[model samples]
Target: MTSSTRNRLFALGALLVAGAGLAYVAFGNIGQNLVFYWTPGEMLAQGSKAYGPTIRLGGVVQPGSLRWDAAHTHLSFRVADTDQPGAPSVPVLSSETPPQMFRERIGVVVEGTFDRSQTFTSSRLMVNHSNEYRPPKPGDGPDKWKTTVSAPTAEAR
Candidate 1:
């Protein structure tokens, strides 16, 4: 074989090895890194298998189950796959203060570990929101925020 053919063969072998390494990593036991989040029902379905490893729990906030102390430092709420009352729910306790937009019936993802006790202790709390934005109408007032912004007084002018 000519020098060029030998070099090409060596390059092909290197490429194949690199590809195999990547495949192993992508398909390997790195489950925790690739998984984004699991729905509440899915997590619950895991049964005993879901007890360890920090995982993201994604679901809707269960209405009437959200509670926060007066200081608002700690929060507790139930998450379900949907806003319906009958959906499977998982109780979650979080130390992080909720975002301003967090509310019942909204999508949320909490990252934490679930114990055999059936409670999820979350270290981080995130509120999911749509990327779409619709600005207020041209003449719309501060009512959009449910607050009043008084116009500049004539006396000050």
Candidate 2:
């Protein structure tokens, strides 16, 4: 109605109810979908604060730290702040097959949870890639459809 008092009170009540619904939604479930991205160093610095939430850990895959199970079904690797050997590293375990582009000393981003034991259990693995297209090797033979397998190079990574 055009009545100002009733209109104002109804607006205030609706605002309060909407706010409460948002808060309830946040507390009940939306929090799980709120993924945060962090580097190995930043995650390590969070200590206990970093555990339990789904996180997208972005960093370089540590060279010589990648291991695959005999069946190749499980993969374990350490991610570092940089390609440097001694940078802060976060141990990751993934049951999912890694992207075809997965390799050591390359940029990668893994999504999963950081458990209390200090290891990140990844449900997803992704390799960081360049945005521009570069010519393939001069004599390189036909690969797997350019290995449309998400295989990438370290040029712009």
Candidate 3:
């Protein structure tokens, strides 16, 4: 091969190696960063493999479910699908302070891992108020009060 061709080939090989290295770096870290969400039923189905893997538990906050220690600031709660009638739920324990919106019947996303005893130890408590805002009714208008209406007086001349 000529000198120019040899240099061109060398550059092409370097570019290919750089591209492969970049691809590996990008894809290799994805599994570590991505978190999977699962319910108690699904986690039970997967058996012990689900243990020690960081994941999010998505479910409803069970009513009257929070028990917190005022002095120690320790807290615990149960999560379930409130919409599904009589569905069994999972218990979550956390030492961190829960979000303000974290209440019964609300949707929550808890992140952590489980142990051999099947207890889910949550490190983070994220309340999900994922509902989109709806505009007020047209005629039943946005304003709560009637500004145009006047209070009745004794004499209007």
Candidate 4:
């Protein structure tokens, strides 16, 4: 081919190589950076492939399922997948102290990996809160509730 034609072909090949490099950098080994979150039901559905990397499992803390070790301050509880209603439970083991909002029937988010024993070795624990809150009215200041409601004076009438 002529010199100009050769230059054009080289430019096209360089562009193709750059595009492929970009694609590999973006999509290659994506699993290493992915922090997946799923419920107990989803994890169970994933079968044995759910282990290895870190993950998040959320569900309500089953009542009477908590077993605390006072010596080590380690706590274990079963998190039932609310989606399945009465589905099988997944156990969570945490060495950290649970949040104050944590209680039976309360939602919890556990971050860790699930082993073959179905036990989630959590590195982080978070307790979900209800969406209910009482705020003061517009006219009511921060200390308005503390103010006494006095009767109107005769002159003011």
TM-score of each: 0.64, 0.64, 0.57, 0.59
lDDT of 3 by residue, 1-157 (tens): 9999999999999999999999987887865546456666666677778888788887886766656554636677778856365676788888777755455577888898887876789888887787677677776664522321121111111
Model 3 regions lying over 4 Å from their true place: 1-36, 83-85, 132-157
Report the lDDT tens digits of candidate 1 across residue range 18-86.
999999888877875466899889899989999999999999988777776556577788999999989
State the number of backbone clashes in model 4: 0
Q: What is the lDDT of residue 38 in candidate 3?
A: 68
Candidate 1's displacement at residue 151, Å, is 28
| Cα-lDDT of candidate 1 | 0.82
Report the number of clashing residue pairs per model: 0, 1, 0, 0
Candidates ranked by lDDT: 1, 2, 4, 3
Which ten-residue region of model 4 has the weakest summed lDDT? 148-157
Off by over 4 Å in 4: 1-36, 83-85, 134-157
The TM-score measured for candidate 3 stands at 0.57
lDDT of each: 0.82, 0.80, 0.71, 0.75
Instruction: Give the candidates in order of TM-score, highest first.
Output: 1, 2, 4, 3
Better of 2 and 4 by lDDT: 2
Residue-wise C-alpha lDDT for candidate 2, range 15-82, written one tens digit per residue: 99999999888787765546456889988988999889888998998977777665657778899999
Candidate 4 per-residue lDDT over residues 92-147, each given as its tens digit: 99977776556567888899889888799998998877797777778877565233
Candidate whose TM-score is highest: 1
